[model samples]
Target: MVFMNYSTSTWILILGPLAVFLVITVWVIELLAKAPPWYPAIPIVIGFAVVFLALGVLIRAKLGKIVF
Candidate 1:
């Protein structure tokens, strides 16, 4: 019998929901500080997310295939 050091299932279930909740909470707090008509804050949030995600993908792709 062997024991695993870490459980990927725990992270897949727990951390996934936790990460979503944290992002939503931060976005709501930011939007509340901005003003009324919550619509505007949405675009800003989405745009920032998209740009960051794209940058991450680009960086990962470059790193995955490197020749020196």
Candidate 2:
């Protein structure tokens, strides 16, 4: 058996894009389809926040090593 150890930055690099893609996709779909008026706006805001945060992390990771 082989075990792989990944750092925090590495994990973020791996999952960040996937998360952003999924969030954006869902948001788009929601936009195209009709949603209930009761639907909250928090998810959309959170999605954008995640994308920005992920981009920031990726930029920092590429420019220099991440401490944690």
Find the candidate with the highest lDDT and give its number: 2
What are the candidates' C-alpha RMSDs? 8.6, 8.0
Q: Please give me the total number of clashing residue pairs in predicted model 2.
A: 0
The Cα error of candidate 2 at residue 58, in Å, is 20
lDDT of 1 by residue, 1-68 (tens): 12133367643543465467558757775876678777567667667666765675565446523421
lDDT of 2 by residue, 1-68 (tens): 11146667777766677678767767765764566663576577567767877786677556534443
Q: Estimate each model's TM-score.
A: 0.40, 0.45
- Candidate 1, residue 60: Cα displacement in angstroms equals 32
Candidate 2 regions off by >4 Å?
1-4, 35-68
* Every candidate's lDDT: 0.57, 0.64
